[model samples]
Target chain A: MPIKNNNNEIGDSELVDSARHGDTVAFGELIGRHSDKIYNRAFSIMRNREDALDISQEAWIKAWQRLSQFNGRSSFLTWINRITINLCLDCLRRNKRFNAESMDQIDEESGGVERQLPIETPNPTRRLERHELRERIDEALQQISHEHRTVLILHEFEGLEYKEIAEAMECSIGTVMSRLFYARRKMAVLLSGLRQEGY
Target chain B: MIDERKELKIQAYLDGELTIFGRYKVNRLLAHNAEARRLHAELNSIQELLHHNELDHPLPEDKESFRTRITHQLRVEGEGTSRVPNRIRPVLKWVAASAATALIIFAGVYSLMSPENSNQTPAHVLLGGESIEPEAANASFITFKSESAKLSVVWVDTKSSPVASPIN
Candidate 1:
């Protein structure tokens, strides 16, 4: 649906067909339509600007190379998102040794592993302006580790099911659920912290 | 840690990733216990936040530069299918050799650094070195005779790697 840009009169399906035939212009059109979303997804997963840039470009190159293999089973954006997500996952894996041991380390100040921070207000996010809420969410996300954050992005933002997440993460469905659960609880703590900060 | 089974039930109920019976059980539990209700409300608010308030981070402002870089790369790749010009053939081999040499030197330097810093090649190191896309290497017929050397450069695609999560 995002493919119908004013500058590009063609639909995504048409562009994909042309790009499959090696039309650079068609592929460029496709890139123009979806690169930002792909870049955003990369940033969400990688949590670094430069890595997001490299990974996003790499995803495009891969999409261009693998264009013909695309069967139109999913939307073009979905296809690109999958490519970007996989690349992010790959980048994360390649560099996993450099990161923290695990995202499972509970915050010392959070009191315990089963931190259920009381939601003081009825709906804190409702009180926030759109941009302010995003800032708060981004801040909260930065506090979580890659594993937890990745699950949150894949489930909530990308709308992938637990099984799909398990497949992408190469883990069991229960692991996916566990990570999702941990991520949500962590988010609750972070959001409540923001509420306390008067954000 | 909380009761693992009870926590799972609460998350399942909130996610609606459960069967009818599991749903009924959590519903009854939440109705009866004030603590469970509070926990449910806290968890459910996160869902609302993610669903209604999640915002995408902005891309770099100079997006056109990125597009230009990708466009140039695509054009270069398009030209790759054509025959390598005779003049550049020898240069490419020398470059590969130089790359191998440089890789060894860089690896030695990286290997000696503080364990924390040497865990992975960071941003500056990669920036300073020449990069060949793995696809570009795939198109070439070079082979490393040394098993250790080959193993060092082997690409590990994380998609297929075995992932062990804490829950598992």
Candidate 2:
């Protein structure tokens, strides 16, 4: 049976079942519950607010249409997030952003400039507050190439393995490792620079 | 200087993505090489920073507005995709075409038999019977009878439009 409309107390599983039965209200509730996380994930990938908003809405619509196929193998948010990530990847491929990463590819093949930088012993980010650190990290993410940042997000944030990321990004596992290593080294360089500035 | 491949191998070991032999190789490199050890430490710290510190952003738009947009799109797409079945589509097209053709033929016959046309013949004679006075046919027999039976019996008011009168 469909849950009463606008009821916030219902669990996600119940709402999902009701939504699968064609209850738009239940689906709306689910959207209301998870839109922020969905939007944030999209923003992390796309790095543009308008694109993120568009992708997030598109993801929700797709999730609604494919609700019956969602067999509860993962949580509703996880399932929906997978949809959002796939859409972001599609948008990336459609825009041919990977072609823009050719220079980064050359860098990866040769270990990049960050390879020669000195490795700092102490934690460079130790002085900054958590909020400042997050802001700096986001700033740093925006500076790197898309492929490298994506590898980092997949491995670190989404907890995907190298093979899984390779499949998602449609690259080889070796490429995944290479990009991930480059991304971390680049991040280390950026954070070390921030620390030396006494922030 | 460590080559890029060995550097990545060290990272893989740090991530626990390495097999047992790969791990053993990285362990030996880290134990012997101070540079590899420092690189490993730096990479480990960065991974920890990212793993625990993914930024949480609130939805830029209000919840109600975002939900409304998504629900509106769903409704529009639902209507757009709710199409007629493929098999029934051709049949419906044929039926519509037949109806249109029939209407066109009916209009053409009606216009040809209209009273406004001076060339129009008497209804009985047009049906291949003897030419009868319009009033005489209406007063006695409403049916148009033909010797060769070229046309069936159909009542027509010569004064009014042809199809307005019913068949006898």
Candidate 3:
């Protein structure tokens, strides 16, 4: 007797294929697997719970509508991430509060020379309690511009490569590098102060 | 002393973006320069902190609301109903109005330009010696032309109306 793999335990590509054939259950499973990360990315960019939820849902809706066009050039998660990021960018564009100029001015005002103090002193953040680090990082992330913060989240949190970050951001690799550099610098300066404050 | 080229190379090296040859050059610089080594440490620390900071932040409970809203929207749209009721209703109203206006104009022109209405004649008529009266209320003299195979009943009024009736 030959052993058989259960259809319910299908891989992402197979699930995608079934979803393309109009199987809503397969698509629902895909959503269940990725919704958390997608929601987190949206929250990271939008900084609002409601907006993040809306964007993630919209991304999934768009994925379903355009599923036939997905040619598997990238992983399904990546394809969906691109959709979510684009939706977030659209939301940001509409808000006018999240524009690049306003963000840059805010950073300049808050990020003076005093903000550049070093935070880590031979104690790795990994060694810190996980919950405290999460709180600190989340708070620190809110201080950076959306553009810088997005690159950081995609690169550091999501573990996307520079090229993938560039694709998600619709920018050149050099731009991704430059943005990542400035973002890391700003984060270091912010987190360093928080550490010294003993938070 | 940190040269400008070396500083840029150090940043690239920390980012893991340097070519192998470029990394070798920066490594050579690091071997002799204390400042280069410090810069490397600072860069490395930043990367580590950024990577580890947000690893465990669970999304808020309300985050799922967006997904629900979007799914509802997609369902509604996929049903093929109007997304913008106000916008589309006005457009449909305009199209209907324009069609009605065209129909009225066509009916009016057709009534006026039809040959039977102008000639005041039945479509088929036969001829004989018998006298046939005109349908309209007026005195008239009947005239028939055999060469053209035409008949005309001229009303008594100088402002006469043309009529054609069969004589049997």
Candidate 4:
């Protein structure tokens, strides 16, 4: 039977149900609804337009194939974004983006330089507009290592718990905590520095 | 100086990942220690900034185009799943085996054809009665080259029997 309901007028749950029954139009509607969020989530981590585009497409394809497996434990967007994040992580791993050592990894691992730096009491986001703050955050995320950046994105944006992040990142809870702490410290520094630079 | 462990505890507190006792301890620390309070405030500001202001980047391409690409990929991958295992696996395996065998044979032939290090002459040239070194009574060494392989060969023989056909 054809799904007679208007696709845009319907909720994601109804679309999901119809898509699960092999309705390509319903699945395409779900894609149309959530593709930007999925692509943004991928872009937030991958930081490359072409890579983000490929991973987002792959995520949707995988979502279509596994639509039957989506149990609706979470929101449909959340479920699909999880797939996008996983694909991003896998692509990062395949490309060895996470394995490359940098000063961020050294600071994170070897009794951090960030550890010795004093805390800035002034709020980094106090004087800035929301878009400015977001631009600063994106710039800072780009400067950090993939591990630190991934942990921050997972915690701050995805709203994943420490344990959930640990599972997704395939590391210990301690590692997640350490990465999060250092990532926050780095963000504090970057935001403060960017504020000082007036950028 | 706030230790690393204490700092992480403060972060965990800010993130609400701490248990009741941990929260209480962190609260006490924040109340007593000026530095910990500053750290907490800083972390909290950053957290709130991140949580509220994640830059919303819309899909750079049109949604319809992106959706069409994904749909095309799904169709391609769906066909691949049905066609790959039963039909393509044997063909892929055969192609792989043929490639491997060809590589090995080419490597062997190339190595054999390399003659930069060779010093001996061809056997046919030797047999053509070119001026040759006289053989010793007890042993003799004959040096030649292979026509097919373009490699030099050295043969050693004793008075009793031929010890080796090709030594080099």
Best by lDDT: 2
Chain B of candidate 2 vs. true chain B, TM:
0.48
DockQ of each: 0.19, 0.31, 0.15, 0.29
Off by over 4 Å in 3: A1-8, A97-121, A161-167, A170-175, A193-199, B1-8, B52-75, B81-168
- Candidate 1 ranges beyond 4 A from true positions: A1-7, A97-99, A103-112, A116-126, A194-199, B82-168
DockQ-based CAPRI category assigned to the predicted complex of candidate 4: acceptable
lDDT ranking from best to worst? 2, 4, 1, 3
Q: In lDDT terms, how accurate is model 2?
A: 0.78
Error of 2 at B77 (Å): 3.3
What's the CA error at residue A18 for candidate 2, in Å? 0.8
What's the TM-score of each model vs. the native? 0.69, 0.73, 0.63, 0.72
Worst 10 residues of 2 chain A by lDDT: A120-129
User: Which one is best on DockQ?
Assistant: 2
How far is each candidate from the true structure, as Cα RMSD in Å? 18.5, 13.6, 15.3, 13.8
Which digits, one per residue and each the tens of the lDDT, describe model 1 over residues A31-129?
Answer: 778888998999988888999988999999999878766889999999989999999988888887224535334442223464544433334533667
TM-score of 4: 0.72
Evaluate model 2: give its TM-score. 0.73
User: What lDDT score is found at residue B131 in candidate 2?
Assistant: 39
Residue A159 error, candidate 2, Å:
0.5
Interface RMSD of 3: 5.9
Models sorted by TM-score, best on top: 2, 4, 1, 3
Worst 10 residues of 4 chain B by lDDT: B117-126
